[model samples]
Target chain A: MVTETDIEKLALLARVALSEQEKEKLRTDVEAILEYVSDIRKVSGGEERAVPSLVNVMREDGTPHEGGVHTETLLSLAPKREGQYVRVKKIL
Target chain B: MSINLSELTIATARRHLANGDFTAVELAQSYLAEIEKKNKNLNAYREVFDDVLEQAKGADKKLPNFRTSKLPNLCGIPIALKDVIMLAGKRAGACSKILEGYVSPYDATAVSKLKVAGAIFLGRTNMDEFAMGSSTENYAYGVTKNPFDESRVAGGSSGGSAAAVAGNMSLAALGSDTGGSVRQPASLCGVVGLKPTYGSVSRFGLMAMSSSLDVIGPFTKTVEDAELLFDAIKGKDPMDSTSVEVSSSKLQVKSLRIGIPTMIRETEGIDPDVRKNFEDCLKQFRDAGHTVKEIELPTMHYALPVYYVIMPAEVSTNLARFDGVKYGLHVSGKNLLEDYVQTRGTGFGMEARRRILLGTYVLSSGYYDAYYAQAVRVRAKIEQELRDVFAGVDCIATPTSPTPAFKIGEKADDPLQMYLADIFTVVANIAGIPAISIPSGTAMREGKQLPLGLQLMAAHGREDVLFEAGKEFEKLRDNRGGV
Candidate 1:
């Protein structure tokens, strides 16, 4: 069973803040979902089968690339923009 | 003759435009009028494009030289796109606040292809936030009501696209199906929805939900229109390396063996009306001289549980991109870490947050092997079982959804119950196979008729079989005078 502490740790790891009420609700919801999916442990056994279609896809290292047409468009979408760059909070 | 937009299919509309019977601008205007009348109650389209007539006017000029100019099949067709798809310079938010005011930088490969085909996009439709929930209720904007019955949900996360096509606001619409996002809503809204085989269509522009399971498909009023849209959009794309080129052969209905999962019907939660409709569909298949056999798929019971584990894990990882600095909702906090917390916590809806938390819990240190790894192994088992079953049968049939469209707040409180709404449709995604949900009949509920869909699953890369079966099933339904 997941406790409030576990929920808190998960919220921290997930980088999402939860209120006391939301955290308590998540604790119950997550616990119920985990208990339900625990059936996977009972059914899954032996060696894992290889999924054939999941092959490593690679592109040539030195292909000429077209410049993105939407640099201005993308920059305009940023919440806080300064000229051509997106502005963010100071870190250090 | 004045055209009734409500009766227009992509196929019929194309012929009318080709023959100069109507201009694309007129066609678009008809749909715009319909959207104006119905969008208030249905909540299908998030934004109707202001330049729809301008785009249609371009198509009208191009329609005259089609034969010599090598115009595409979808030329001059007006269509709707689910909000999750990116169209350069347009807002593609997946119905979430985090992505509010965010404009796409480039066209999704599918969108680019549709544009190249001279298809006029009418607008972007609403959907569940990040395509996370079974109903469109998870939307930060508003829930899309079923066009047939306003009180019930249009099955989601492509609910808006389904509603748009069902309400005749657009000829056809593009929808991305991750765990039945396309098919369930299509079923609920009484339209045709196809989820092509994994990697069949490029996902370069679609907002990632569960990357492994997300396949962009179409919602149309007819199977033939779905085929046209699928053909126009499907191909290998360099931007999406997972896409592969697969050749298809014609499917012969006379020689087809349709497998019915007897065990699935015996499973709980299926409504009696849905079962009867399914049985009626089978009887129609039999009357049409096709064989239906009961097949046991024991792993079917475990699909929902496996999906819940695997999908949320992928969702958690995929959604990490919305950190708020670059393109979406950005909130300032004391520090960088707190910035992410506040932005996401405030931006995401309850369903999205719950899934993110569940995903984080499963992928966390101690529980990775217990939940995530185990779920993968079982997923492989399910895939293998489906492969073995396909060797013996041409296609497998099941109810697209357990019941008709449920009331809006019916399953809202219980997340688990809401997840169960996709129970019958997720198996195709998990196994990387093609599935189509076509309207079989309608069931009566609360003095109103709600649509029920029959789902058909085919082997990987065999969407041809699905289309063939779907076309035949549609014919049988029409013969019986059933919508």
Candidate 2:
């Protein structure tokens, strides 16, 4: 069973703040969902398999000139921006 | 006389445009008028693009010369897009508060192809927040009601797109499916929806939900429209590495063998009306001189549970990009970390939060092997079983959903109950194969006829089989005077 403390820790890990009420609700919902999905435990002894015919596609390490078409547009979507850079809180 | 927008299909509209019966502008106006009449009540479209007529004008210029000039298939057809699919300069929030003000900087690969095809964008459609819920109730915007019955849900995460097509607001719509988001809603709304092979369609510019499981597909009134949209949108793209070349082969309906999963049909929670409809569909196939046999997919029972584990884990990771810094909703807090917590807590809907938390739990250090790893192993087993079944059968058949559209708020509070809506549809995504849902017939619920769908799944890269069988199924139904 997922306890309130465990739910809180998960919230912290997921970077989502939950109120006391929401956390309590999530605790129950999470427990119920986990219980339902615990059926996966019944299946045992299968080797890890990757999708067949899939290959690692590699591309050259340089940006194409056509890719720059969206640069200014992407920068404009930033909520907080300075000049051409996206602004964020100082990590230091 | 003005064209009837309700009965207008891509093929018929194209022919009319070619004959100059009505201009593209006239067709666009007819749909816009219909949307105006029903959109407020049905809540199918999140926003109707202001430049719809302008786009129609562009298409009109090419329509007259279509015969002489090389014209793409979807020329002048008005289409709707699920909000999760990015269209350049359009608001695509995925119906989530977190992306409330985000405008896509570029078109998704599929959208770009649609533009090249001269298809006009009607607007972005509503969806479950980040495509998380089986019903559109989780949307930050208003819930999209079913066109057939206003009080019931339209099935969801792609609910709004399905509703738009079914309600005559758009001829067709594009929707993303991660665990039946497209097919389930299409079933409930009584339309055709297809989820192509996992990597057949490019995922570039689509908001990631479950990266591996996610696919962009179409919802239309007929299988041919679905195929047209699929052909226009599908292909390997330089933008999406996972995209691959898909080859097509002609499949004869008479020679094909369809597999029916006896185990899944006997599973508990299937509604009697749905079972009846499914059995009737199989009878039609058998009567058409096609062989229908019972095939056992032993690992299918674990598909839903495996999907829950795998999807949420990817969801937690994919959605981590929505911090309050670069784009979308940003809330100030005491510190950087707190800012993320506050922004996400306030912005994400309840279902998104629950899934994220569950994902975090499953991927945690101590539980990773027991939950996530175990789920992966079982997923492989399910895929292998499906591949083995496909070797013998041309396609597999099932009900798109266990039941018809439920009343709004029926399973809102209960997550498990809602998850059951995708039970029959998720195996296609789990096995990374192509699947389509077509309206088989209707079932009476509460004295109203609710639409039920027959789901047909084909082997990876064998969408031709689905389209061939689906068209034949429709013909059989039409011959019987059923829609």
Q: Write one digit per residue (lDDT tens) for candidate 1, span A1-92.
A: 78999999888888888999998888999888888889877884546654555888998788355676557777888888899788887888
Angstrom error of the Cα, residue B58, model 2: value is: 0.6
Report the C-alpha lDDT of model 2 over B356-410, residue by residue, as the tens digit. 9999999999999889988888888888899899999999999999999999989
lDDT per residue as tens, model 1, B1-483: 598876788888888888889888888888999999999999999999888999998988878778466555677798899999999878888888898788888899999999888999999998888888878985467889998899999989999999999998889999999999999999999999999999989999999999889999999999998988989999899899899886767786565689998767577999998999999999998888888998878787788899999999998999888898987888888988889999999888888889998898889888898888888888888888889999899999999999899999898888889988988898999998999999999998888989999999999999999989899999999989968
Which numbered prediction scores highest in lDDT against the true structure?
A: 2
lDDT of 1: 0.89
Reference-based lDDT, residue B456, model 2: 98
Candidate 2 lDDT (Cα, 0 to 1)? 0.91
